[model samples]
Target: MKINIFKNIFENRFSFYRQQGRRQRSRHSQKKERKIGKLKDEIIGLRRRYEKVKKLKRQLQHANLDSPEVKTQRIFQGHKDSSHVRKALQCHFAVLGAVKHKYRGLKNTKSKQSLAQLVSDKLIKKYKCKTYCKKLIGCVSRRKIKRKLA
Candidate 1:
């Protein structure tokens, strides 16, 4: 009789734990969903602010802050905001070329950072270019690639 009673108790406890596990999992997912929604809202807010700034920059150019004809014409030709996105769009072809340039040489290198350093080093050696600027670009591009892969 005692053995039967112990078996019954263990079965009840196991069943209770299974139900609790389900509840915990459901609550955790709900929390994740809420956090994701909050992040989405924050991104939307940032994009809106970026657009507003771009618009103001356009208006400033039109108001003739500099030479009227020159400013107006230059603004549309990819000199409007000076933001990352603007730089990216303006220099898309250049960056594409750079990417290709980097890719062709990355295969022999052991690590990405080393590969980037080599590129910057090579550019500096070949062109006598600005080391600081080229190094910064190399580091940033390497980080972007790492983040994208992750």
Candidate 2:
């Protein structure tokens, strides 16, 4: 019978490779955990913003629509009347709340971008924009008004 020294060495080397493969997998899993932690941090920040928007919406809803202070706000907004502006603000707040609720657990950038597009579409619909330029102009005009007031 021949002594098979080479076969014994090959078997040992194969076992070493298997152990190294398991170590590599564990290291890869650790990296995935770190990425998940980063995503969790991002989610936390988004949730904070979501809470703030929600609180603002609630405050706006409970506000007295016919008060003297609110009347001044209506004049500067360029809408035909306070009621119309209030409705518009309420509609946008609802849309934003929906977006925040739907995207609360989403971690991907593409999903966030899609949510932003959805919000923009809702804004255009609420404002009754006939064209994209008109919507853009409204945003610019609002900023200009804000700057003048400042």
Please give the CA lDDT of all the candidate structures.
0.61, 0.64
User: What C-alpha lDDT does candidate 1 achieve relative to the native structure?
Assistant: 0.61
Q: Model 2: which residue pairs collide?
A: none
* Local error of candidate 1 at residue 140 (angstroms): 68
Q: Give the alpha carbon lDDT tens digit for every residue of 1-150 in model 1.
A: 999999999999999999999999999999999999999999999999999999999987778333323333465674456455443333433334445666687767556565455445433343333344455464456567899999
Instruction: Write down the TM-score of every candidate.
Output: 0.40, 0.39
Top-TM-score structure, candidate number: 1
List model 2 lDDT by residue over 2-114, tens digit each.
Answer: 35888888889999999999999999999999999999999999999999999999998899774434545665576566665565554444455445655774677676456
At residue 63, give the lDDT of candidate 2.
98
What are the clash counts of all predictions, listed in order? 0, 0
Candidate 2 yields a Cα-based lDDT of 0.64
Model 2 misplacement above 4 A: 1-4, 78-150
